[model samples]
Target: MGEENNQTVVTEFIILGFPSLKKLYPLLFLLFLLIYVFTITGNIIIFTTVLTNYKLQIPMFYFLNHLSAMEIWYTSVIVPKMLSSFVSENKSISFSSCMVQLYLFSSLGASECYLLTAMAYDRYLAICQPLHYSSKMTNLTSHQLASGSWVGGFLSPVLPVVLISKLLFCGPNQVNYFYCDAQPLLKLACSSTQFTETAITTLATGLIFSSFLLTVLSYIFIISTILGIPSITGRNKAFSTCAAHLIVVMIYYGTITAMYMQPMSRFSLDINKVLSLLYTVVTPMLNPIIYSLRNNEMKHSLTKFFKQIDKRKN
Candidate 1:
């Protein structure tokens, strides 16, 4: 449906991003601006390093490469707009722009869920089914899993966006949050949002929790297998491979569950914004660090990558 129709009077929305911190706009802007740059730069480094370094061309790094690229797109979707709200007074977003933002944000979030699951499963095979790791996680298989993740994630948000777009918003155009989130938009709907809310919640639960369940199950097996290893060094090595990913999963799901899994309308708007920041801003920056810091191979690759760059300049 078109944004402007007889039933819907409000064609745009004012995103009241962190209104409680309005007095500290300059500090917040500078802070998140630095974060945005770091997030983009860090993920780019990971992506480029994984792609070029021959020794890092394995299934784990392959997935990490895709994840780094996604993080770039993911942060690009929301952070720039957030910075705008911090710097400029014009916090208004057109209806179409809002929907597009919501769609992209949700799609990338969903893709990450599936991508993380794929990574977990890859770790599972590497540790638990070592005999079959190579055959099971072939290049083609990795390609399929990663492509499926992106496809499924992008498709998951289509119905919700379409339904929300059709909702009537007669009076309030003020979205009391950082982004064009479904819950906040629903709160401002002129029409009854019972069905829309139910639909979005149901889809989110299935999408988010199911991926969580799969990832957990894979890790459970991986942990059990690690414990069964006869040598302490072997167990440590096995655990190290997946430890960073496990921490990342916990933080990602923890924040997402807190924000989107419940009735967010009942929560304080500031709390909601904080929860949003954990995943949208903080997690992306931390991911590459977690992976590179924990994985010796990744660190070696990164060091080699920089040395090569310096050599080229010299």
Candidate 2:
């Protein structure tokens, strides 16, 4: 009787992603397909370029390799499901499958946050304290930092997933969005979400806010050091190196903050979905382009890479 009673309370969720724009489905499908292909290709290229180019074997490129890897998984976590939703009439995920998606997506997202922080600190040491940079960010230290980011990122989401698993699902099983997310999953829990929400919020705050603060602080010091340069050319050159990092940081953090920090009531559900898409899909697609376009080293490496390929072909 008790189990039956609990089952009656909740069943599933209705995911209303991109709300019934029947006309837009075809266009949206093609657009997202292209975006996914580009995102995968771009990140793979960056990862390969960094690995093969002897010049890019430094700490920064090491971090870039991990970031590219994260981007690959991160974009994969949401985009494929989203694209499928556009074409398929039935948008449904099994309870177990939803949990898996949630776990992997949140894990990758948290990992990227810490990875970005590590990258920022790498830049800080390189730019602001070039004298001690080599010793401070030694190969061993870089390996440790990179390993920590991956481990920490994986651990951060485990608690929430465990907590979520304890909840019962009774009736409404439809998740309104293309993929599983914490917010949507929370809404479907038959049990009270007070404890789960509080726990997830605390973890997110610690992971996102702390990493963001550290990155911001590192850049502040970095900007100050760049400003201290006496020569205009020197300052310009210095700022250019950091500019790509800053731009990507702003776009990523800005969208994330906008999406997660706001009260649910303020925005429509569709708006929330769009914002989520921006951060999860659009940003990953843009990272390599933003980083490579402004980076002379990456461009040079890419050119040399293509030339080498051409020589081998001939």
TM-scores of all models? 0.96, 0.93
Stretches off by above 4 angstroms in model 2 are 1-16, 262-266, 312-314
Q: Following a full C-alpha superposition, what root-mean-square deviation does model 1 have from the true structure? A: 2.3
Per-residue accuracy of model 2 over 6-55 as CA lDDT, tens digit each: 55644334545676786899999999999999999999999999999999
Please report how far candidate 2 places residue 47 from its true position, in Å: 0.7
* Residue 47 lDDT in candidate 2: 94
> Residue 293 of model 1: what lDDT?
97
Q: Residue 22 CA error for candidate 1 (Å)?
A: 0.9
| Local distance difference test values of all predictions, in order | 0.92, 0.84
Model 1 misplaced stretches (Cα beyond 4 Å): 1-8
Quality of model 1 by C-alpha lDDT: 0.92
Looking at model 2, report the run of 10 residues with the lowest lDDT sum: 6-15
